[model samples]
Target: MRLDGKVALITGASEGIGAACAAELAACGARLSLTARSEEGLRKAGPGALITPGDLTSEDTRRAVVERTLERFGAIDILINNAGIGSYLPSWSAPLEEARRLMELNYFALLGMTQLVAPHMRARRSGVIVNVSSIGGKVTLPWSTLYSATKYAVNGLTEGMRVELWGDGVRTMLVCPGYVQTGFQKNTRFGHAPDGVVKARRFAITAAQCATAIRRGLERDARTVVTPRSGWILVALSRVFPSLVEARMAKINGTA
Candidate 1:
């Protein structure tokens, strides 16, 4: 629970879940090294911190983040892979190249960053990775298949990682949140959504609520974490009665 003096690196730290996490983690007493494309936003997270403004979609930028974190903090202890993009169009309708870019950030960059950090954690035999995924990773819906697919990839990555890191003393976890009230959805590039869907999504849990759940997951070292009572209840029900849950979610997506 206490992260006093721990060095943490947070991607997508300019705003939304990343910024909220920076605030929460800083309050928990950890020094933060935050990265995003926004220098101004990163500056706002200050309190004995280092901020890096770069595109996470670039391999060079991703590695530089790790290198900068190490150079600034001496060693990386916690990595919150919260940087990602959402596509709001149908996969086929979406631009192939744009989707590739999405994959670069949502899947490949996360994997590469983890690969870069895991060995260091393995060397120390201790570290925590909190990959920010989404509830759509756990199920399918109408449009947004590509966006969902990327999150699904994150889900798979997190699971396989836990197996590999076991007994190596490295902890890997996936944090899946449902319709977090953030600019991510509004600013999405593809994976189309109806206006009704967007409206409903706006009323979902706040970033702070999701960040609180993330802090708990890090503290407890959870395998997978979900935010808000409704989110977990749905995930649980999906496991308990998949068909029923699917039928219900279908209605929510207006697919039924």
Candidate 2:
């Protein structure tokens, strides 16, 4: 369905992909609850957009965001679980607390927001939940093991949730994309990636392109949307030939 009159909540809308998605949905007439830790960024990007400035990892913040959406728009039809953070690191080099914190936003916040919004959607008998994961969620990249793991959690979660949520009139879309030319890497904690990650940075997509694909997916209510074209081929290969996919990734990591 079209997003013409719907209300949507998108986390991490201060910039990057989240910002672009908010712009796209708002362009389609969806009232927006755009959230991020940067209040200034939200104000600058959104201007007239409703802003929720807080760390979404907090349960209180998550609840407040949904509540505010309900307050302003009266109903929440679309929940875009797009806020994610990563500290480029290997399993050991990564700080345990930092990894846990990342999971809090990338995994827990996503689930929490869905739980808060789903009942309303179920009662209303229609809604959409778009979980923005990554190509890294589908496969591990060197120096980004912890980030990959968190995304893997999201990948599994949205899949199982989609099956159970389907009959409730909630459609879940898991968006897996290759590297976007966003500040995702620069903004990352970089647990041990002092030299930087070469592999992931190479095959980069753009925020605008990613947003366009997401809009089309939400419009048609597609199950999963992959961007940069090659993403589809990689995902397809990973499903049937996981070993091969990992092997290919291993080679890429070797260079990184």
Candidate 3:
């Protein structure tokens, strides 16, 4: 609902969309508790923003971040599960362990943080949980199959959680962003993007645009938010013409 004076805990708060969310929320009058592996980056989020630097894959780190946030704010009005890794490896040859690792951060960690913060939100009877998925979640992207799989899991979980938490006053929102100009590609957990994929970055939106959509979605208690607005056209196209979409994706990714 109203963001004024609310306390939000955001993971992956160091840079990119996460940093933009932190700034946007802060401007909305929400206090922020930010977590990431970069202390320096976290500090840049804002002077008043609480910084919890650590690996999100670790349960200990998750616990510590939540505990510290609660200890400082006494309540968590918003939980933004924005910490995630990307994989560009082809499923046919991608290592299983790497897949698992990607899931650990992208899906499992999001689940863990939600599990920890949900009870608190339920008890308060007023809160929001924002899961940052990707447009890939809505439509599978070739050569990044595992990444899409993880995001698809996010999309599913956010939906289920939204229904399960209905009338609980705890809103769940899913943010599905198209390619955004961020360090995501350079820091991918496994495999680099093909030349075609890299070239596609030319049309990517900025991280701030994605963050703005996320903030607006939270304010409106939206069920799902697909950023770059036009991305919705692609999602709709995929649903209406799956074969055409798949064939095009395969060609774009050099699969066929």
lDDT of each: 0.84, 0.84, 0.93
Candidate maximizing lDDT: 3
Number of the top-ranking candidate, with TM-score as the measure? 3
Checking candidate 3 for backbone clashes, the offending pairs are none
Stretches of candidate 3 off by over 4 Å are none
Deviating ranges (above 4 Å) for candidate 2: 192-202, 239-244
lDDT, ranked from best to worst: 3, 1, 2
lDDT-best of 2 and 3: 3
List model 1 lDDT by residue over 107-169, tens digit each: 998888889888999999889988999887887655567888899899999999899888998
lDDT of 3 by residue, 26-144 (tens): 99999999999999999997678989999999999999999999999999999999998889888988889999999999999999999999999999898989999999999999878
lDDT of 2 by residue, 78-151 (tens): 89999998766667766788888888888998999888999999999899889999888886765578888989
Clashing pairs in 2: none
TM-score of 3: 0.98
Error of 2 at 11 (Å): 0.3
Worst 10 residues of 2 by lDDT: 191-200
